[model samples]
Target: MTETKTIQKTFWQKYSTLMISLVVLVIYGWALTGLTFSGIQESAGEVSSSIFHGLTHPDWAYVYDGSGEDLVSLILQTLAIAFLGTVISAVLSVPFAFWAARGKNEGKLHPRSTTGKFMLVLIRTFPEIVLAIMFIKAVGPGSFAGVLAVSIHSIGMLGKLFSEALENMDHGADEAIYAAGGTATDVLTLATIPTIMPEFLSYTLYRFEIAVRSASILGMVGAGGIGTPLLFAIQTRSWDRVGIILLGIIIMVTAIDWLSGMLRKKLV
Candidate 1:
């Protein structure tokens, strides 16, 4: 009887807090949202109907027409922007990542200098679309503006990723190089870079894939890419042409995903 009582007490002790917490959360949510069983049913019905209609087949005739050129050009331009942006960002991120990693430097300076940290924060805080718009205004519409926009945003993103990778690196190699009286540059070349190379390449390629998609959209703001064609098609109410553009985008993005997946598999 004593053992049975102890077990019962333990079970309640472990679960009582969780049970109470769940009850409180549910009550709070319902009170705040004013949600009822009827509301849930209504929402479910509306969502189901909307989703059903949205999935209907697109116009097929556009695929055979020559209107696909705009989409094809937009896609190519977007790819070009993404590719250039990623390359520029990768190049710039390397030095920043090297400086940001701890134990890689024995100086009085912080692992990430105040300016560097602030710049990274600033770059990350702004949306890439906003940057693209701003650049479009400054540089006028074209692939170059899109590339600059993506590059700036990518630098912030990749810098952080590269820094984390560097931090996780083994200290032994860097320490050994320093002990051998190697300079910072020498140590970075001989030890830090080689160790982090695979991760760096993998991240860069992954960013490239994302940039390609983003570039297409950036064209909506007059930044050059397939987005321009898409916008034109939509404005003209040319659903047939829109269909072609959508199909091309789908194919291109899928190809990029597949290629990147294969590359990542080899890298990792």
Candidate 2:
């Protein structure tokens, strides 16, 4: 009886978590089914043809946009928003990350405590589109709004990753610095930053890739990017134009992904 009980316990320990996860997934799938479009079957044939045709025959003329400002230029705008946003977030996240990182101290006001965690969570709760809309109201619809939206969203992400990197840094040097009467700023500047710089760079590059995609989507909301024109092309049934814009997005994202991946491998 004892042996049988032990076997049963082990089996349950191994499979109970999986069973719960399966149950949760089933429930979510059922909910999603209810939310799915009921008319998809009716529209799928026509939609498929339109999409297929558009993708196959993109307008090369729109690819360069005649005089100079074209799909490429708009894509460059998207890249600029993402680049600036990532830089801004990377710079701003440092202090928040240090505050959020777990350290030697403990208790409510201790440096080791997660006092900044709540703030980070709050910031991340709002999606980039929502933030873009808000910023559009504040700054008007343009690249500025897109930049602000991406920057704010990037901050939450960078801060979380940065804090994790800080928490996992070599404590020996930091302890020595503290013991030698070094200030928090000194330790961070000299020890913490150096130790985590590689990981920080890797995360920043990854975030920039995501920001590029996000910048394009934010453009759909009038935040300023190729998305506005892409939307217009779609609404006007200009599939040729849509194809050009999509191709531009695909090329830009692919190139950035490749470069960032290479850099990350070298750094990390």
Candidate 3:
């Protein structure tokens, strides 16, 4: 009876993986059946040629001539928007993080955390483009609208990141403080804040890199950035201008990513 039972368990184990694999394959097949493919356009070749010609002969004049609509100026403005948005979002994420990652909920279900987690999901799910349009309508189109959109959109991601950091944090210092009859303020200043600040800073720096890219895109909708001029160039069929703007954005984003990486390493 023992040998029979052992053989039966082994047989199930051997087939379970195959069964799961078959199910996954079926799901993928079903999903793929719903996809629709579009054919290439007749003007695709001409459009591609124009784009390549522009890239090969980028408008060097657009870099800077103090027109204020130049690539350099617009790129700088985009960076500023990203920086402001990142800082504001980092600050706002703190309370959300703490609320979602409460120590008391460890190893157990907590409705407060569930609700907070759901709220974060909702925040994240709200599209940044939509937020930008709303802000533009509310405060008129400009860099300020972009800043608000980026900051608010960033909260969901940053809050989730910060909460994970908090959950993984070393609670030993917190306990040590409590055992020594330390005040809550003492625990916060001595243990809680210090224990998590570095990680928080690191995450903020990482998020800043994403913010920079987002800021550039937000400008497309008149939130103000390099995107404004880029869109204008596209609409006007001035492909060279678009090429220069794209180059500038690439250089700026690459530089910021490198700098953010260095800062994150230091903080970590």
User: What's the alpha carbon RMSD for model 1?
Assistant: 6.0
Pitting candidate 1 against candidate 3, the one with the higher lDDT is: 3
> Quick one: best TM-score, which candidate?
3
Q: Which stretches of candidate 3 lie over 4 Å from their true place?
A: 1-25, 35-38, 104-107
- Tell me how far the alpha carbon of residue 51 in candidate 1 is from the true structure, in angstroms, after superposition: 13
Instruction: Please provide, for model 3 over 1-268, each residue's C-alpha lDDT reduced to its tens digit, 9 standing for 90 to 100.
Output: 9999999999989999998999999999999999997988999999999989998789999899998988889999999999999999999999999877757445546776777788889999978889999999999999999999999999999999998898888889988999999989999899989999999999999999999999999988999988898888999988888888889989999999999898898899
Tens digits of per-residue lDDT for model 1, 1-268: 9999999999999999999999999999889897545545647777556434433445554444455454555577678999999999999988776555554454436745545656677888877789988988898878888999999999888987887787777878888999999998988789978988999999999999999889879888888888887888778755556666777788999999999989999997
What ranking emerges by lDDT with the best candidate at the front?
3, 2, 1
TM-score of each: 0.75, 0.87, 0.90
Q: Mind sharing the TM-score for model 2? A: 0.87
Q: Please, what are the lDDT tens digits per residue for candidate 2 over residues 34-129?
A: 875546587789988997898789999887745545898898899999999999999998888977877755554664445687778888999999
Q: List residue ranges in candidate 1 displaced over 4 A.
A: 1-69, 104-115
Cα-based lDDT at residue 48, candidate 1: 58
Candidate models: Cα lDDT each: 0.80, 0.89, 0.91
Better of 1 and 2 by TM-score: 2
In model 1, the Cα lDDT at residue 237 comes to: 56
**Candidate 2 residue pairs that clash:** none
